[model samples]
Target: MTPYTPPTQDQLLAISVNAGIEELTQSEKFAHAESDLVEAIVEGVGQFAAGEFAPLNRIGDLEGAKLENGVVRLPDGFKEAYDAYVEQGWNAIASPEEFGGQGLPFTLSCNVLENLGAANMAFNLLPMLSVGAIEALEHHGSKDQQTKYLPDLVSGKWSGTMNLTEPAAGSDVGALRSTAVPIEEGEHAGKYKIAGQKIYITWGEHELAENIIHLVLARLPDAPKGSRGISLFLVPKYHVNDDGSLGNRNDLRCVSLEHKLGINASPTCVMSYGDNDECIGELVGQENRGLLAMFTMMNNARINVGNQGAHIAERATQQALYYAMDRVQSARAGAPDKTPVAIIEHPDVRRMILRMKALTEGVRALLYYCAGQVDRGTIGDGDAKNRAEILVPLVKAWGTDTGVEVTGIGIQIHGGMGFVEETGAAQHWRDSRIAPIYEGTNGIQAADLVTRKLGIEGGEAMIALFDEIARDAAEQPTLLALAKDCAHIVRWMRDEASLDDRLAGSVPFCTMAAVAVAGWQLLKQDKAVSAGAAPALAESKPVSVRFFLDHIVPEAHGLKASAIAGADLLYTLPSDKLVAG
Candidate 1:
């Protein structure tokens, strides 16, 4: 098997350049940083990921996490690995300095996330979720809440979990039955007793941190119906005392751990809160406004999910490439020799490898670029903020879908051996599967893109994005025609298509947009190559871009056609008839 290697300096630089990081660094808001600083950080993170985290990937898959009694015990070495991660100060690399963070750009942080995620996804999720919690608290938490929680959460001493799912609620968060009732009298009069059960909670219970901080979504006594009645709360596993010491345990416990198809090392818990009516939780932002604050955390998580997609794809690609080169098979089509040759020499194997390579690099380019927009948005760039908002769904949906496709291809490249668990190829597929379902299902993401994002600011963001795509195609021959097709689709959604039609096409539109953005990023790479700056291992960039243009670009056009076709055909059949065998 081929050994996993960290991304090189040139690859990092090329990605950064394509992501517009250098341009952002020159702006007044980001002028404090330099390209060299980011490069160094990427190199450092790569080393840490390759050494401390990569070795744990298979170990985590094999050992997995176990639930014994009521406690969730991590697989062996997980605790030590997590400790090493925290001790290295990686948890605060992108957090604000006021909260004891390094205050670095999220673009750089995303690079770190990609490396760590590729190394060991289950382990990487711990700190990744914490970072999202920190963002939520920093943006919406009260001053007192910030002082008490930000430091520990930012420093990774306390891990965090987002509790938005329930067996009854799932994606329809408004259907949640969790309740938070205010205590009118007591030492904690301002707090509320939270009573509810949440399932599919990732890292809901873990031993890696001093405490597990849960950002829960529940309804108050006087709250309205549906989502409008929901509120956000901070419920810690172990209560904090007046002096910052640990208090009695909260009334919450992990009732059970889910047995899953992948990411077995990460504990997915079914948590019961306030079983004894003692689960006290403090309001995060305002009463009945929990969804607003929780959206912050969820939005952050969506981007990371995209990164996870890219990460898993990269890992699968490495494994597949290695196997293809090393696994000797039948002789080549035109070879004179009768001796068997490596599978990599075969045309079909080469096509599969190219497909994997193109999708992996393309998605990585899209995700990093999305992160860069987030950085600009953080700096108060309204246009960039709008761009980021619209791109979030596409990144999350397309990236994960690509991950699944690429990983499946990886399995196929390995032939029957890939189906066996021992080769580790199948695990990538299992791990990648969850990303599409994470944050929100890809179907939901597509719906959001068509409904909420396109109509924002009078469609100004969508308009600007499409305009940029058109302009981008002028220099890249592959995109020139697709860009024109994208423009017509945008118009169709805006004027020709009804709301139902838009919804029907939303998934395709989002997929189309993702491919377009990826093509744009790859075009930047093509330009970089043309300019005489290239990586030592970048011989594949040109070919990968070409493969994407030839094989993937037409799929975008087909999706556009489907989107334009509307939902009429989908509803033609009666519901009962559709279900008939």
Candidate 2:
């Protein structure tokens, strides 16, 4: 077994920037997030990872979570750690300043979240939900509503949940059956009584905080059918008074918690509203526009899910590297028979390890770059905003899909040990599985990319993205050739390719776009590296950027070809031929 040496800070920075991460910090819109701010966030995240969060990960999994008397109880030390998290004001990173938040860039907030996810995913979910609620409220909530609820949520004195999925409506919010009836002029005149069941609510019921604010979607009594009737609401577990203190428990109650395959520490609950005739909800935005309002939160949440995937990949890679270095195996081909070599010495093992490292770092770069885009879109000038909007779907879809693959490789690198639950490798694999499935699944994300984002502003935004990629690629001949190939493929896939044909190769089309986008981002980093940027951060830029372009970018070719191959083979297969009689 060989001693393990952590990658240097400079090396990480170089690889990250080469991956297009530092651009997030340097962008003019994010100028406020100076080096000192980044350092502070990094330091805080590092401390949380090392001291509070990482140590309790195994404990949380081992004990799991329990539902007793309608309340979810976390494993030992979970509450204390959560409190410590709040005490550090980690939850307020992205919240507005008026709401007792730091109002920092999402890029910085995302960096902190990545570390937290890497440390303990279950623990991180509570605050993640709260942030989502905050976004929805900030964007669409009435001024009165925001003033009343935003402070506690931002301060982490309370938590939040999004209630969308039900037994009948998981992916299709339009199929939702929840009802919201306006109250007669009485004690709750301005409110509506919500009656419905929402399933799979993360952090649905927990003892982690004093209250839970639920952002629910329900149809009004006189509303039209389908999604047109749907509306967003703020339903709390406990009502608050004019003074902002907690009041009586609301009508929402957790019937029970789900026993899940993974993320066992984060309570997934079945919530029952209006069971006792007391679930009062405040309408958000206009009636029948709930889904639109929810999109604000969902979009942000989708990106966060991508971050989850990236974080898990990073952790899994670190674990695999550690195991590879320590696990003694057969001697290398050239080594003496008497001496055993570390598994990392095996050519195949090294290859797997390198793939894991490359994928993890590459996805991290993508996630950070996406976060930077988000920051720019929110704070930058008009041009930056346009670019950021164009990149959203690409970031959401590609980051998550790649994350799953990277984590899977992490598991494979562990071999037999990977399958065993005790090794914790399998847990990462299981945890990552859900990212692509939820948050507007990768297929949906791809459809959004091609159908919406590509054509945004008459395709100008996508054109801009391509121009940037081309400009960056011109600096390196190898990458330029690859970029040209990708551009050619994208054009063909969009214009020449048939929808029915592409639908058969839907997965491949998505994969192709992901590959091209990743290559483009890496090329951007390569350009940054050549410009003699931060030395420490530019170190890994050349090698990683080249590795991705040479080895990974070629995948776009296969995907593009498959996408153009037509759907006849898939759709033509008779129903009888597809299944055994």
Candidate 3:
């Protein structure tokens, strides 16, 4: 496995030009995140990631996380690496000023996540989950709650997890049967006894932090049914007294840790709360509104999950590029001496490598762009907020899908060696495979795009985005056509398509829309390169953007018909007919 090296030039250009980092820095809220300061932060984080995290990735993958005697243990060096992460305050980069954070733009924080994810994806999960919890608390938790928890969470001295999934309720949060009953009178009055079993909790258990803060979704005894009944609670592993000292252990325990396909070093726990009728927690917000608050966390996480896709793809691309240049293979087509040359010289190999490069860069641009919009949204830009909401699903779904595709291509570039564990090409794929599945599966993201996003401002946000793309691609005919097609699809999904019909085509529509967005973002970089804005990437940027627009953007054309195809055919066959005998 090659040590991860940060693609500083490309990353800087993506965040600066495509994401408009300077524009973000100009905002009063993010004035401190000046371009030079952001650059230095990115550089320092890259070095730290390359040095501390990259070296342990293989070991983390091989050893995975362990659970023994009710204790969850991370891979060797993993604890020290996490301690370093907390000690350096990387986790607090985007947290609020009142919460002991630097209060920098989320754009820079996402860059931090990208670097760490590229270096070691599994190791990144510990903090990634914390990021989500921080958002949830910052937005929904009470002042007392924030005063007690936010400091440690922001400082990374403590960790956090989102416990939403139950064994029976994965995508559907409302189906779970967790219950929280109010305490009428006691020292813990106003709090509730939370009792439920939640599964698939990422980083649910770990010793890296001093405490684990769990954001749980449960229902009040008198709560309404389904999603409307859900309530968010802040449940700590150990009770925290008003004076900030730890008390006895709470009633939650990790009954078991899941055996996963990837990110094995991050424990996915099946947590049982109040097994002995002692798990106590307080409401995060108004009752019956937990879903809304949790979405605050999930939405933030969805974008970062997309970020995971981008960086994991970056990692795979780096390894494959290195391997292609180093591995000796058959001679070139016109080699006179017939000496074995590197496989990178092969035409087919070049094709695959370029695809990986183009897609990785393009997706990364979208990731940063999407995150920058989120920061813009935070600063009271309603239009930007709506746009960020629209872009989240696209970035999450397409970015992860791209990650999967690029990693697979990386394997192909490595030939048989890629399949072997020693080459470490397969680990990237194994790790990325989960990104699209978790964080509201890509299918769900697509469904959100079609069902919800297109309905925003009667589809104005979607239309305006496509219009911007179409306008930018005026000189580029292929990209312009795709952008126009996307606009048309938005209108169709909004005006003509029925709910069932829109859903039937939602996944493909998401792919098409994402391709167009990524294409335009790449075009931004291409134009920047041509205009001398990114002198460092003059030669490579155009090549990558050209490939993406020419080869990748056309993929949207193929998805157009499928995207709007109605649901009739999908329901033509009954459930029994499609079932296995």
Number of colliding residue pairs in model 2: 3
- What is the lDDT, from 0 to 100, of the residue 542 in candidate 1? 82
Clashes by residue pair, model 1: 232-290
Which stretches of candidate 1 lie above 4 Å from their native place? Answer: 1-3, 9-11, 27-29
State residue 150's C-alpha deviation in candidate 3, in Å: 0.4
How well is each residue in 1-581 modelled by candidate 1, as lDDT tens digits? 24457765434744565557777777765675576777777888888888888888887888888888888897677778788888888888888889899887787778888889988888888888998999999999999999899899998999999999999888999999999999999888999999999999999998889999999999999799999999999999999987778899999999999999898889999999999999999999989999999999999999999988888888899999999999999999988997999999999999999999989888988887788889888888888888889889988999999999999999999999999988989989988899999799999999998888888886767877767877977866657667777667777787778999999988888898889888888778777766665655457678888999888877786776787888999999989998759
Rank by TM-score, descending?
A: 3, 1, 2
CA-lDDT, candidates in order? 0.86, 0.75, 0.91
Candidate 2 — what's its lDDT? Answer: 0.75
Q: Residue-wise lDDT of candidate 2 within 1-581, one digit each (tens)?
A: 11112233522453345323355556554456665666667766766765787777777777888987777888788889889888989989878988898877777677767778878777778888888899999999989999999999998889999999999987888999999999989899989999999998999988889899999999998888888889999999889999988899998888988887777788888999999777899999999999999989998888788778777777777888888888898889886675888989999888877776666666666666666667657754566666656556666677777767877887787889888878888877777777777778888877676666656676566655665666766765554555555556456656776766545555665565555556766566566657875466566667766777767766655565676677777767788898976
Whole-model lDDT, candidate 3?
A: 0.91
Segments of candidate 3 deviating more than 4 angstroms: 334-337, 579-581
Top lDDT prediction, candidate number: 3
Model 2 weakest 10-residue run by lDDT: 1-10
